[model samples]
Target: MSQAPRRTVVVLAAGEGKRMKSATPKVLHSLLGRTLLGHVLVAAGAAEAEQTVVVVGHQAEQVREHLAEVAPAAVPVLQAVQNGTGHAVRIALEAVPEAAGTVVVLNGDVPLLRPETVASLIAAHESAARAATVLAAAVDDPSGLGRIVRDASGGLARIVEERDASAEEREIREINAGIYVFEAAALRAALGKLSTDNEQGEEYLTDVFGLLVEVGSPVGVFVAPDVEETLGANDRAQLAELRALLRDRVNTAWMRSGVSILDPATAWIDVTVTLEPDAVIDQNTQLKGASAVAAGAVIGPDTTLVDTSVGAGATVLRAHAVGAEIGPEAVVGPFSYLRPGTRLGRKSKIGGFVEAKNSELGEGAKVPHLSYVGDATVGAGANVGAGTIVANYDGVRKSRTVVGEAAFVGSDTVLIAPVEVGPGAYVAAGSVIAKDVPAGNLGVTRAQQRNVEGWTARRRPGSKSAAAAEVAERAAAGAGEVSEAE
Candidate 1:
C-alpha cells in the first residue's frame, strides 16, 4: 500500500480586525487568559497536523512574538498588503512542503473550532477522493454570510457572497463556514487561477471551490454539528459573547467532573485553574493563574484567588488571596487579604478584616479580626488578638516579629518589629512591646493609671453634685410647707 500523505495546516491571522477597534491584532485578543490564536493553535495540535503555517500581516511583529511563546512549532509567513483570505492562503501555501498531500485552512478568530471537526473534514475529503472539502453550517440568521450553492447532485457548486447573491440564492440557510481542507496539488493549481474580480476587489478563497467544480473535480461539504463552533468574533460585543460561551463550556466540564459551582454565570475560572472533585465554588468568584482548590473546600461568595492553593476542607469567604497557600481545614475571611508569601497552617484561622503578607501562621494559630500580620511568624496555638498590628516596617527597613508557641498576644497590642514573644508569654491588652518578652512572663508597656480627686465635678459638665443639690433643695421646700401647715 502507498504511504499516506502528510497533513499541513494554514492559519490565517493577518487581518487587522478593524471591526475590533483595537490597536492590538484581533487574533491576539485574550479569551479565557489565552489569545484567540492560541486556541486555534491548540486545536491544530489536537488535529495532529504534520506542519503548521501561520499567515500574519497586521502587527506582524507582535503576532510573531506571541507565536514564538505559544506555538513555537508553527512557522509564520508575512502578507505585506491588506488582501482577502485567498491571498493570505496563497502566501501560506508557499511554505508547505511538497510532500504534503492535504492542506487545511483555518481562521484565527474562531477559537471554538474543535479538532474533531478538522479531522472529520479531512477524512471526508480523503475518503471520497475529492479535490476540496468545505465546512458548512445552517444558521437561523445568515445575513452578511456567504451562501453555499450546491449542484443538482447535492455537491458543493460555489459559494455566493451576500452582496453578489441573487434574490433566490440569498434565501439559502446553508452558509460557508470559512474553513476548508484541500488536496495539496489541486489547491495549488486553483490558487493560480484566482482573480481579484469580486465586489471587494480582493481574491476570495471561495473562488477556489468554484474553480474546482468547473474543472470537474469533486467538492465535498461537512456541515458542523454545532453551528456555534464555526462562529468568529469581529467586534467587541461578539468577542464578549464568544467568551461567555467558552466559559460555559469549560465550567460545564468541571461541574460534570464533580465540582459544584453555585452560580455558573457569576463564577469565572481561568483555563489554568484546577478544582479537585467535590470543591464548591460560590457566586461572583474568580479563580485565576494556576490556582487549585482541593476536594471538599469552599471558596468565594465574592472572592478572587490568583496563583493560590486551597487545601482540603478549607473555607475561604469574601477573600482576595494571591501567591498564598491555605492549609487544610483553615478558615479565612468574610473579608481578608492574603498577599504573597502567606502560608496559613492546618486548622488556623485568619478572620475578617485581617491582612497578612509574607507571614507564616503555624498550625492552630489564630489571627482573629482586625489585624495586620506582615513579615512575621506565629507559632502553633498562638493567638493574635483583635486590633493587633505587627509593626514590621520601620522608616528604613522591614523587620520580623516572632511569636513562640502558645503565646497570647493581647487585643490592641502593637508588637514592634525585631521583637519576640517567648513561649507561654502573655502580652497585656493595649501594650506596645518593643523588646523581647521572656517565657511565661507578662509584657505590659502602658502607663499606670492615676486617680484625680473631684476631677469629674470640676472639669466635666452635668456633674453628679449639681443634680444632688437640686434634689436636696426640693426636699427642704417640702419640709418647710409641712411645718407651716402644722
Candidate 2:
C-alpha cells in the first residue's frame, strides 16, 4: 500500500520575550489584531497540514487560553520550563498522536511565513528523504543569526550560531530561518540526542544539525523567497513594525481582491478578517478580530469594528462597533456606536449619535438620531425616534426594554429599565415611561401645562439691559463714519 500523505506542523512558541517586558506571552502579543501564533496557525491551516501542534511556555496558561479562544486549531503543549527550542520541540512531540507524517517545525513569532514556503520545505524533505531540511534566507545582516556553513566542495555542512561561530564563519550571509522540515523519526532521534554545550548552556536545536550531518543523515537547506519572514519580535518597537507590515499586506490583499479601499494608508485590518469582493472601506477604518465585511459593504472614514460581522450591502457610516453583528442592507450611523451584543437585522437603520449595547434590532427597525438602547430587543419595522433613551440601567441592577413589532418610540422618550412596549405601541414625545405599555396602546405621561404668557418679556428689559442700551448708543455715536459715494 502507498504511504499516506505526511504533513505535520510544529509551531514553537516557548520564547520568554524578555525584551518585550510585557506580562503577555510573546506569541500572544498581537500583530494586526491577532496574536503572533494566530498568524502562524492560519498559515499552517492554509498549508493544509495533517496535524498542527503549538509548543507554549512562559505564560503557558494565557497562551493556551488565547489558543482556545482565537485559534482553536493550534493544539497547545506546554513546555514546563523553557530550556530551548529543542526542548520545546520535544514537548510538542509528546502532544503529537503519531509521527508517521512529515514534521515541519516553525517559530510562532515568525508570522509572515507563506504557505508556499512551508510547502516547499515539506516537499524538499520528502523529495530527498533527508533527515532534516532547513528553510534558509540570505540576509544583509545575519550577524546574530546561525550561519549556514558548507564544506570546501560546496556540500551541506552544519549551522553555527553567532556565539559559536568564528569571525570568518560569521561573515556567511545565509542564515537559518528557524523553520525546518524533518523526517519524523530522524527528528525524534536527533531531539533525543541534543546537548547544551553551547555558550548559553541551553539545549540548542541547531546542534542537532551537526549531529545529523555527522551520522550521514542527509541535511540540506531550502532558501526562502523573503528573508523578512524570519524576523521575530523581541521588543515593543519590533512588534509595532510587524503590525504595520501585516496591516499593509492584509489591506493590499483586500484591495487586490476587488475591494475598493478609499485610503489604504490609514486602513487597518486583522489577518483573519474576510472582506468580500467590491467591499468599500474608507479612511481610518479598523476591521479587527475575525470581523468580516460582505460584498458591497461600505465601512467608514472613522469606523472601527471589533469582533463584528457585517453582512452584504450593509453601510456602516463613521461608526464604532464592538462585538456586534449587522445583517444585510443595514444602515448604521455617520457618528454612531454599537457595543457588545448589539445585533441588527436586515434593512435596519441605526442613525447618528446612537449607541446600542446588548440589544437586538429586528428586521427593518430604525433607530434614527441621538438614541441609547441597551439591554433591549426591538422588534421588526419598529421606529425608534430621535433622542429616545432606553433607560435600561438602575442603581442596583440593569433591566431590559422590549419594544414589539411596528412600535413607535417618540423623541426624548425614556423607557425606564425593566419596561416593555408591546406590538404597535406608541410612546409620546418627552414621555418618561416608568411602566410597560400594552399592544397597540399609546404611553404618554405629560403633566398638564399651565403656560406662563409673556414670561420672556417679564424677565427681560432690566436695569442691566438699560445700561447696556445706553452704552450701545454712546458706542454707535463714536463709530467711524463710512464713506458713501453717490
Candidate 3:
C-alpha cells in the first residue's frame, strides 16, 4: 500500500517591485480588500497542501508583520538577499525537512491562482512520476517569455528563454507560465548543481527543467484552463488591471448571489465587500475595504463607503462614509459625510449637507441640513435644525458637545464646544449659545434687533447717486470759499 503523499507549497514573494515605486512591499499592496500574498496563501491552503512556506527578501520585517496580521498560521523564511527566483526557492527549501514528496511553486504577485488549477498540477506531477511539471499557456504573444520545447513524443523536453531561443523557436506561442510542481528529490539534486553562468549571473528556476531532461527524467506540461490566472503584476498598470479584474469578479459574484446592481460597470466592489440578497446598489457607488451591506440596504446613485458597515433596511443616498457604522433603518443624506468613528443609531436621520466625525447619534436623533457635528454625543429623540454648527475645535484643543434626550436645537444655532443642552430644553432660532441650558429652559443668546426704516432703499443704486451729488455740492461750496480767500 502507498502512503499519503507529502506536499509542500513554496511561494516566491521576495521581489522589490521597483516598478511599483512604493515604499510598501509589493506583495503587501492590496488587491481588492486583501494583500496579494494573502490571496496566494488562501489558494495554497485551498489546494490542501500539507506545508506552506513564504520566502521574503526586501522589507522582510514589514512583510512578516503584515503576514502575521493577515495569516499567522503560515510559515515564513527569510531570503536575506536580492537573488533570482531559483535562489529564492532554495532559501525556502531550507525550512522543509523531507525531500521525497511534491513541491508546488507559486508566485506571490499572481493573486488569481485557483485551487483547482493547483490541485490539477499536483495530480499530474504525482501520477506521471515526472521530475518536473510546468504550467503552460498559449498566449497571444509570447515575445519576452520562455518558450516551451517539446520532445518527439510531444512531452515537454525543455524551456528556452527569449534571449536563448533560436529564430524559429522564438515564434512558439506556447510559453512557460512560471508555475511548476516538482518532485522534491529531483528538485534538490538539480538545484545542487545549478550555476549562474548566464548573462544575468543569477540562478534560474527554469534551469531545473533542462537538468531533468538531461538526466533521462521526463519534464511534463499542464495547460492552464484560463491564461489570465498566470499573469503576474510587475508594475502599477498591471496592478490596476488586476484590481479591475478582481472588481469584476466580485460584482459578478454578488449579482449571482441575489444582489441587484443597477449599474455594474460603474460600481466598484472590493474583494471582501459583501452584499446580501435583495441589496441594491446604484451607479458611481464604491463599496471598498471589507464593507458589508445587509439585505434591503439601498446604496447611492453616487456614494463611497470605506471600511464601513451598513445594517439591514438602511438607505444611504449620495453619501460618503469612511470607517463608520450605520445602524438598521438609518437614513443618511443626499449629501452627507460620515467620517471615522461616526455611528448613527437605528431609525436616525442625517439630512443633506451634514458632516459627522467622531460622534454618536442615538435612536430617533435627527440632524437635518447644513450642520457639522464633531466630537459630540447626541441622545435619543433629539432634533437639530439647519445651519447648526458644533464648534468642536477651540484654538488649542478639541472639545465635545452633548445634547440630551428630546432636546430641540433651533436653526442657525451654535453649540459651542464643551457645552451641553439638557433634556426637554429648546434653543431659539438664530441663537449664538455660549453656555449650557437647563432642562425645560429656553436658551436665547441674541440681543433684540433694532430695524431702521428704508435702509434698503437708501443703499439702492439710484439713491446712492443722489447722495453722492449732495456730497459733491457741499465740497464745491467749500472750494469756492477757499478760492475767494486766495
Candidate 4:
C-alpha cells in the first residue's frame, strides 16, 4: 500500500484588521465563544494536517499567548511587519520542512470553512496530481472580492483582485475564496519567484497560480458547495452575521440530538455548552462556557448560565447563574442570582429575588424569597424564610453562617456571622442573632413590643377614630348598595 502524503497547513492571521477598529487583533475576536483563529485551527486539525503553522504580526505576543492556551500543537511564526498575504505565506513556508508532500493555506478569519471541505480539497489536489488547487465560489455579488480568471483553454489563469481587475474581469461571478492547496515543491518554487510588482508594492499570492500555469503545471479549481462557508468578516456587522450563522448551525445540531429549544432564534448557546437529551430550553436563554444541562431540566424564558451545571428534573426560571451546580429536582428562581461556588442540593428550592454566593444548601433545604446567602451552609431540610439575610461580611473579615439540619430560620431575620443555628433550632422573625443557638432551642433578639394607646390621634390631626368612622361609613354604604341591587 502507498503511504499517505505528509500534509502541512499554514494559517495567515497577521492582518491588523484596521476595518474592525478594535484594540485586539482581528483573528482574536470571538465567534460563538471561540476566537476566529481558534475555529480555523480546529478545522485544520480535523482535516488531519500533520503539521500546522500560524503567521502572526499585529499584536503578535497576545495572539501567541492565546495560541499557547488553545492550540499549543501549532507552531507560531512572526512576520514582524504588515506586507501582504504572499509575504505572510512566505514566512509561514520557512517553518515547514522541504519534504512536506502537500501544503494547505487558510485565512484565519474564515471561521465557517469546514474541515470536510478542506479534506475534499486535499484529496482532489492529490488525486488529480495538480500543482495547485483553489477553492472558488460563485456568489451573487462579488464586489470587493478577487475574481477567478481563466485562460484560453478555460483553465484557472490567475486571480485578479478587485482593485487591479478591468471592468470586464470585475463582472466575473466566480470569485477566488482565498483558500488554496499546493504541491509542496511547486509552492516553494513559486514563493522564491514572488515579486512586489503590483500597484500596492506588495507581493501577491494570486501571482503564484499564474506562475504555475506558465510552467505548464496543472491548476485545478474546487467550487465550494456553500458560498457562505467561504465568507470572512472584516467589520463588526459582518462579524455579527457570521456569529448568527454559526449559532444557528450549533443550535440546529443540538435540536437534532434531542434537546428541546422552544425558540432557537432567541436561544444563544455557545459552542462549548453540552445539553443532555430531553432538556427543555426556553426563549432568550444563553447557555455559555462549558455549561451542561441534564435531561428533563427546564431552563429559562430569560436565563443565562455560564460554566454552570443543571441537574436532571430541575427547573431554573429567569435566573442568572455562573460557576454554580444546581442539584436534581431543585427549583431556582423566577428571578434568582447564583454566583460562583454555589451548589444547590437535590429537591431544594431557591425562590424569587434570592441571591446565593459561595454557599452550599443541603438536600431539601429551602431559601424562599427575598434572601441573600453568601459564604454559608444550610443543612438538610432547613427552612430559610423570606427576607432572611446571612451577614457573612464584617468590617475586618468575612465569615460563614451555618444552619444545622431541620432548622427553622424565621422571616426578616439576620444571622450575623460567625453564628450557627443548631439542629432543630428555631430563629424568631425580625431577630438579629449574633451568637450560636443551642440544638433544639429558639434564638430571638428583639425589643419587646409596647402598646401606645391614642398615640396616633395625638400625633396626627386626622386621628385614628375618624379614619375608623370613615371606613365604617363606606362599609354601610356598600351594604346598602348591595341590598338595593339584589
lDDT rank order: 4, 1, 3, 2
Query: Candidate 4 — which pairs collide?
Result: none
Runs with alpha carbons beyond 4 Å of true place in candidate 1: 1-5, 96-99, 395-397, 438-441, 450-486
* Candidate 1 C-alpha RMSD relative to the actual structure: 5.0
All models: lDDT?
0.91, 0.86, 0.88, 0.92
- lDDT for residue 439 in candidate 2, whole number 0-100: 100
**Tens-place lDDT digits, model 2, residues 104-124:** 888888888877777777777
Lowest lDDT sum, 10 consecutive residues, model 2, at 477-486
At residue 307, candidate 4 shows an lDDT of 97
Clashing pairs in 3: none
Candidate 1: pairs in clash: none
- Lowest lDDT sum, 10 consecutive residues, model 3, at 453-462
Local accuracy of candidate 3 as per-residue lDDT tens digits, 1-486: 978888888988888999899998899888877888988887777556677888998898998898888778767889877678889888788787664588998888888777788888888888988889999999998877899999898988788878778999999999988889998988988988788877777788998999988989878999999987787787899898988887777788899999999998889988778789999999999999879999999999899999999999999999999999998889999999999999999988889999999999999999989999999888899999899999999899999999989999999999998999999899999997789998889999888899875454556646766677668768998999999999
lDDT of 1 at 116: 80
For model 3, what is the alpha-carbon lDDT of residue 195? Answer: 84
Q: Which candidate number maximizes TM-score?
A: 4
* TM-score between candidate 2 and the true structure: 0.85
What digit string (tens of lDDT, one per residue) describes model 4 on residues 113-170? 8888888888899999999999999999999999999879888999888989999999
